[model samples]
Target: MTRKDNSVARLYRLAQSARSGQWNLEHDIDWSRRPRLPFWMRRAQARKALSQLYHGEMATSDLCEALLADATEDRYEVRSCLGLQLQDERRHAAAYQRYLEALGGIDPLDDGLQRALTAARHGPFGNLGAMLAYHVVIEGELLRLHGVLAQFVPCPLLRDINRLVGHDEARHVAFGKIYLPEAVQALSDDERRALYAWLEGLWQDAADSALNRRRANLAIATFFRRWLGGGWTRHAKALDSLGLPSATGREQAA
Candidate 1:
């Protein structure tokens, strides 16, 4: 097939997968299968989860806007990927919002959420390569962390939500893997170096949220243990090979 044909085929496949995944989550997944949490813990866990998710939505919105602001016609593939990512992020945020409402309404504009938004807005813009690195490398780490969380969260509702979110994230990571190399290859050596530095800085920012938080009531500790065991390290290596510095390297640079 021609390159144009391949691109069309890939786009179709991604769209189809996204549609199927959406249908499955909405229809096939037994949302009712999970028992309700006890009143107190339900409120607590929901608050915590919803707060984190709201902050994530704010951050992704900032990133998406930043990407769109810099995008050109030549960057069609990257724009397409970012568009899909933005959609997924919005959907995930809506899902969390629904859960929060079901548990009891949550305050959407918390200080934590505002701070996350501010952080994303103020983040450095190190050209197209650096943007790809942030999406493909740093966000990929978050996807892996969520996968681990899906396995161990005690509440069935949360487990189901995390599992569904993980599936969507896997597709985002795949899209990144497919496109990031091309973006990196297009950059000059000096641009690549700047991109790497920007990525390392983002990695430090991500590590605090992805690895450091201590949620006393949830399975966060168990998830962290599994993440640290080998999984996260492997992910770090994969990201490193994709042009970002490894987690250890990021720490050293810091």
Candidate 2:
């Protein structure tokens, strides 16, 4: 088998292994324990941010389903990995929804995240761009966000959720990293440029939304800014590695 074939085989193995690694929401998280929300986190602004995150999980699930629908049988390993991720995303959305209910009912999805969801659902790009946008960019940022939440949130239940979800997200991102390089080699210049444009807009929308959220809540401004910086750096590196145009430098300025 070629190196690309080996990578796909490995991804399939990882997906199969993920079956046993999965945690049950009802059993794994100790719901009996009391959840202590920090004073600042209890505000409406914080709740809104959490609501956006919850909605993101739902959006990810939807995107996974879309990706799976378009997947062909030729790429068995890749399709299997995506199928596993689809299940993971659904469970993540359910977990986040329950967590939101414990804090307060879910809020309306933020405009930025809502825009992202729309793009993921109805983007003009082909399969490669969709995977790059959803798996590499969105899920990559989400992996970092899960770490941030796990570390910052005092509640054990929330920490557990982040830990478990982060593990699955890491696998999803891994699939993109392994698969995209080969797929990108097949793209025409025009297709690459189109994808870069689409992803640029997606990145900007998310940054603008995050900035708006930060400005609205003074208490978490530092956290938001730091998160944005990390996300920009991650995007820059991913773009460079993928041989795509690096627009994150411009995003950093904005």
Best by TM-score: 2
Query: 37, model 2: CA deviation in Å?
Result: 1.4
The per-model lDDT (C-alpha) reads 0.59, 0.74
Candidate 1 lDDT over residue span 75-190, tens digit each: 55556666777777776776666666666666655443344345445556444544454455445544654554454345677667767777777777676666665566676666
> Which regions in candidate 1 have their CA more than 4 angstroms from the true location?
1-12, 24-42, 65-71, 74-80, 107-122, 126-130, 205-235, 245-254
Q: Could you tell me how far off, in angstroms, the CA of residue 223 lies in candidate 1 after the best superposition?
A: 9.1
Clashing pairs in 1: none
Give the clash count for each candidate. Answer: 0, 0
TM-score on alpha carbons, each prediction: 0.66, 0.85
Model 2 segments more than 4 A misplaced: 71-74, 212-226, 245-254
| Top lDDT prediction, candidate number | 2
As for candidate 2, its clashing pairs are: none
The TM-score of candidate 2 is: 0.85
